[model samples]
Target chain A: MILTAAFFSAAIVAGTPLLFATLGEIITEKAGNLNLGVEGMMLMGAVMGFMVGLKTNSPFLAILAAAVAGGAGAFIYAFLTVTLRANQVVSGLTLTIFGTGFSGFIGKGLVGEIMTVDIRKFFAPVEVPLLSKIPIVGQVFFHQDMFVYLGYILAVLLGIYMYKTSKGLNLTAVGENPAAADVASISVSMYKYLHILLGGALCGLGGAYLSLVYVPAWQENITAGRGWIAVALVIFATWNPYKALFGSYLFGGLDIIGFRIQGSGLAVNQYFINMLPYLVTIIVLVTISFRKSKKNSPPAGLSVPYFREER
Target chain B: MKKQLSFLLVAALILSLVLAGCGGNKPAETPAEKDMVVGFIYVGPIGDGGYTFAHNEGRLHLEQELGVKTLYKENVAEEDQEVMNAVADMIDQGATVVFATSFGHMDGLEKASKEYPEVAFMHCSGFKMTENMGNYFGRMYQARYLSGIVAGLKTETNNIGYVGAFEIPEVVRGLNAFTLGVKSVNPEAVVNFKTTQTWYDPATEKEAAKALLDAGADVIAQHQDTAGPQQAAEEAGAFSIGYNTDMKAAAPGAYMTAPIWNWGPYYVTQVQAVIDGTWKAESYWGGMADEIVALAPLTELAPAEAAELIEAAKAKFISGETDVFVGPINDNEGNLKIAEGQKLTDEEMLSMDWYVEGVKK
Candidate 1:
């Protein structure tokens, strides 16, 4: 029982950052842009968030600064793809390169610096008396940092906004066929820019989670490809926001299982156990790709640079 | 168009003037000029707060004490061509002495050293070297042995965990020495080893440390850079030994004194040699006597008796009265690799690949 509780706790904390990144990428992909630069963007966000959090000693302001930095980065993608009609894939790759180099250069001076934040001191967890006392499910669902609860709420809200509203339908139509949506008097470009910026902001928040709440200190390459895993989860979820929440938890479980297995003295090879999550990702991708039925593929016009030419 | 052209012309003239001013202040050369420009190429971001952090601290010491002009490129990937390109760029920018600070940077440094024979090349933790190239590393095993003395005496479970970075000789030697040191005191202690191929992945390092703790190990030690293992040990209520630097602050309750490499003194010596026009290529493997390898202060958690034993061992090592790997030492396979009353030759120690007795392979 204790071990199960420990596993669930580890899952929730480990999954928070991935949940943020996946949900952010899902929104961007729905806007007809596939940003391969999520890794780079998250790295920039991590560094900038650490710098701000360390300097200001305020987690809230650090997250805000990170969101702005992320939005600024997304704006570069917006200009290249929306304004200049550059290849979205190429532009996203270049953005990642720029972000990695820029972050490393700026992070050089932050080595060995200690960072402190008091989010829990400012706002404590609210326990629901009966709900908090249940079994494994209750502890997993009810007892978590504020960010874990927020991630679930964001997923539900995003799902409602993507599928249940007229504005959501219009956004979906634009992603499927921007030219047809534009003919119907919808501003396809405007929706694209809006969703892209929103996605960028969420990614930045995810980065702040690393420095402010997760590791809560400065370390280079700290994200450790969590951003890339988030991007992979976007595809694994078939671009659905709600599924991403569960997918993030599954990845988190796989990650923590290696340690759990090693702790048990099961005589398993640590290398094979360490490679479990990555191996599962490959298996998941293969299963999704080889399914016999027609399923949720990406939007038809996604990654196609929009121009106002003859239909 | 005319305004733009005139602006371009003025900008070009000003840029050249600034460049000339920056380069024109070289002091008048004596017949025997004694100045050196050193370059460093790093494999990871220097702000990793672990391995790279320690190396960068060494570089800074070189600058402050020896007054050498230091240039460095951070986050250079381990690809051979990319490393060569960075080395060539540094050489073009006037690097007289270059230090490639990773095992993967060895071949590129060797090739570049051959291409530019006049330049001195020092590769860290690398075995291959030429006339103008030398490998330099401290006897980290000596310090690890000292730390293990504390682990052996302090542990209640008689089980120790080792989170290793690679299967390379340097790491293997550290593990073997640590296990031997532990067994010297406890006799019944067993070391559980886990190797995570990379040197700086904190998530994996942390998990490895936790796994070791879970498997009933009461004390943990690591060869990786980050304090992940230390943090894991603290969380798991187990004691830990740290590497590269003093990590007592990271895990106040769990930290045992760590084996640390003090590169500052070596950096000061090497840079001074370069500046005095007396630099020569030679492998340097210093230990406690020279202060190249020293132990961090024991944390409050270490037992009083254990601390005493560690101090005694450290004193013996510092006074040149003890050798950690003397015969009759048996390898892991139960074969006697060194004869009774015999110390290993320098060449034998350099290429050591086998674990000593009581170390799990």
Candidate 2:
């Protein structure tokens, strides 16, 4: 029973970052801006957050720095694709490459340096008064670190903001048909810019979670292609914030289930076990391809740059 | 105007690519200006805080002690072509001696050795050797055994966990030696072993450790590089044994001791030999006596008797009184793998594939 709880708890811990990054991309795509630079932005965030955490020794300041760094990276992408009329795919891919190299260059000195201040305590699990008394659910859900709680709150709030609000409806229209939205008196560029920055900030938070809560230390390329996993997760969630949450946790669970199988004294090839998550991803992707529900489809204006004069 | 702007951007991108290519082809120093240069090619980034970090530390030590110009290319992929390129790059930079610190680099280094007969090449943790190339590895299993003793005594629960990187011989040998150490001290203790199949991935490694702890393992030991498992042990308030380097800082409360490689002394000796024209191609597996491998200082988390026990075992290793693979050993299936009053030869130990009796999966 304890092992089962540990499994779910570990899944949540692993999935929190994916949830944040997926939600960020979903928001950006809703504004008709397909930002493929999620990996790059997260790397920027991871390195910057670790640097600030080392300097100020404050978790809050570190997270803030991470968001700012990620936003800065997005700003470059936004300018190139949205304003300069460059290819969105090319621009986003360049951002990934640039952010990766930039983070490694900047984080060179932080390698192997022990944290002067222990921020693990600051981000440690805070047990809720009455809720944590519950059997398995409370221990798995309420006993998570500050970031996991924040991820839950953010996912719920974003779900409401994306579906229930009038602005969100307009954002959806902008994604489906920017010219129609422009004719309907919505500022397309303004929405794209705001959500792109917001998306980048969330991706940055995802990166911060790894450097702060996961490893709680600095390592180069620490995100380890998780940013790309987040990109896959955005599609797996079918553009719904709640679904994204489920998908992230599910992905996280599949990632570590192999160890649990081995821990049970079962003799299984570790390679095959390690391949479980990606294999499931491929199967899910294939299954999703057969379902052509319009609601489940990607944003219409995704990867398409808007031109007002052409309209 | 738009067309001109796009054209200019394209030109800039092409220019940058050309410039990058030019940088790669930069000329080496003239013969008279050339000095003794040592090059290191690593499989991972120096900041990985595991294997590469230890090697980088040794590189730094070599610089300080020998006063030689050193060059290193970190994050060099283990692919044969990439290793060859890295070696050629170092040679182009006038490196007289190159050390490829990864097992996967053996094939590439062997091929490079024939290509560059004048230069000396050293590969770590592989058997392949050429006239100008040699392989070197420390007997890390010795320290693994000592740390296992510490974990065995420290654990209140008889379940001890080991986070391994792969199913390779290096990791398997370490795990077996560790289980033997644990059994020697506490016969009832069982060592649970699981592989992450990755050298360093903090998130997954930590999860593997957590799974072990959740399964009632009160102590953790790892053959992986990252401190993820150690940090997990610390969070669970369980004892841990670290590898590659002294990782006490990663998990102050959980850390007991670690098996570490002191490559500076060995690197210096090899480089000095090359300078004196005494370099040779031979398989060198140094043990505690050579100081190439040693156990990290035990923290207060260890049992009081851990110190004396570890000291006695270490002395035996140093004095050649006993080795880790001495027989009366049985595989986990209860099959006699090594007969009584016999010992495993170096060739046998290098290719160890089976688990000891106390190891569980």
Candidate 3:
């Protein structure tokens, strides 16, 4: 029972970044832009975040710098795909390659470098008063850092914003049919630019969350393909923020479960256990494709660049 | 329609050319045809300051000692087609001998050796070899034994954490050797292991070390390709024994000693063998006596008697007076692995799959 509680706790810790990145990409896709540069943006955010966070020793400042850097990283993809009218897939992939290389280059000196400051206390778990009396639920969910609570609030708030607000409907309209949205007087470029930047910022924050609250250290490729996992989670959840939250946590749990089960005196093959997450991803991707609905489908104008004059 | 067809053809041509260019990723450097060049493929970046860094140092030494130019491709993913492409590019650029580092590069190295029969291919830490291909690794377990002695004496908790990269034979051998050293000095000491199953992930390595520290481990030993574990030990104010290279700079306050690799001598020999037409298919496993594996300098935090113990052990190993795997060995589950008065053969040592007593694997 104690082991079960710790395993679940580890799940939430691993899933927080995925939730953040998925949320960012969902918002971006809803704005009619399929930005596949989440991995690159996350890497940029991770290095810059660690650099700023380590230098200032202030979590807030570090996160802000990471977000800004992530935003700046996405600005390149936005400019190429939105302004220059480049192929979205090509531009996004280039951004990933460029971002990955640039971040690695910048992080060259920081590799093997240790932090002088101890920022663990700042990002440490803050148990909720009175609610801590509960069993596994309280230990796993209620006893988390500000980033987790931020995830809860952000998920609920983003869900409401997507389904309830007039602006969100307008954004959805732009993704479904940009010409129709333009006819209805919604600025396509404005929405795309805003959401892309917003997505980049969130992805950056996710990266910061990884380097700050989770591991609280800096290293090259520290995101370790988590950004790519977020991309897959977005699809697995069918662009729903709530589903993304649950699915991301499940993956996070699986990541830790393999080690936990082995450590619990099982003679299981570690390789087969490690392959669980990717194997599950394939299953998720395949199952979701069998059922199609208006709500379940990807945005129509996702990878298509809006050309108002062509219409 | 004709103009549109021509445009499509031009686009296809441009696309193919661009794809071809991307496949060649290496810079189109036209070296003097007569210049003798050796190629190196690194799984991680050279700046990693651990595994790749150690190999890069050997490459630099090989260049200086042999007066030959060395070219390298860094950050090549061993599992990706990058390995094949990088090796092919090296061949195209007139490389005579290629050193492919990382176990994941095994299949690729084998394929490349068969394809480029004229080129001498050498792989690190792999078991595969061909007519012109060879695999070479040092007996790092000897140095690991010495470092373990330091950890056993230095640890007040008698609990040492080992952050292992994988559950492979090399790592298992190192773990057993280390446990033996620790037990020889401090019989009550026990080693716990946390495997990340990755070679160069810093964050995971740190997390494993932290978990060990949380479990009351006072000393951290690791086989990963980074300084993250060493740094983790530093942060936790615990002692560390790093692999591949010295952890003195990575964790000055926590560094005890490291089982380090000095690949320069072997690399020079390989290059000289190729030049002298004496290159052959052989599995090279040099030990402490060969200067291929040695312990780093003991830091101030290490036990005072560690220096003397290591000196005596080093001399014994050099003189074949001691074998780390000699007789009376028991697996971690308390099963006798090697019988009394038996010396473990190279095959048993190479394919070691069980943990020694005192190791929580």
Instruction: Give the winner by lDDT.
Output: 2
- Candidate 2: which docking quality band? medium
In angstroms, the error of model 1 at B243 is 1.3
Worst 10 residues of 1 chain A by lDDT: A117-126
TM-score for all models, in order of appearance: 0.85, 0.95, 0.82
Candidate 1 chain B superposition, TM-score: 0.85
Tens-place lDDT per residue, model 1, B92-172, is 777888888888888888888898998888988788889898888888888999888888988899889899888787888
| lDDT by residue for model 3 (B268-309), tens | 999999988898878888899999998988888888988888
True contacts kept of 2: 0.78
Local lDDT at B152 for model 3: 86
Candidate 1 regions with alpha-carbon error over 4 angstroms: A1-5, A117-129, A139-141, A262-295, B1-34, B79-94, B153-160, B187-190, B213-218, B235-239, B248-254, B271-279, B327-361
Which pairs of residues collide in candidate 1? none
Report the Cα lDDT for residue B154, model 3: 91
TM-score preference between candidates 1 and 3, better one: 1
Summarize candidate 2's per-residue lDDT along A1-311 as a digit string, tens digits.
43588799899988988888998999988888888999999989998998999898888899999999888888888888787867988999999999898888789898775444567778888997898889999999999898999998999999999899999899899899999999999998888888889899999999989888888888888888889888888877878899988889987787778888884656677678656656766776777678767788888889898999988
Best of the candidates, TM-score? 2
lDDT of 1 by residue, A67-158 (tens): 88777788889877887678999988887777776566567687566455255233234454687789877777887767777888999999
Q: Model 2, range B254-302, lDDT digits (tens) per residue?
A: 8989999899999999998998998898889999999898899888888
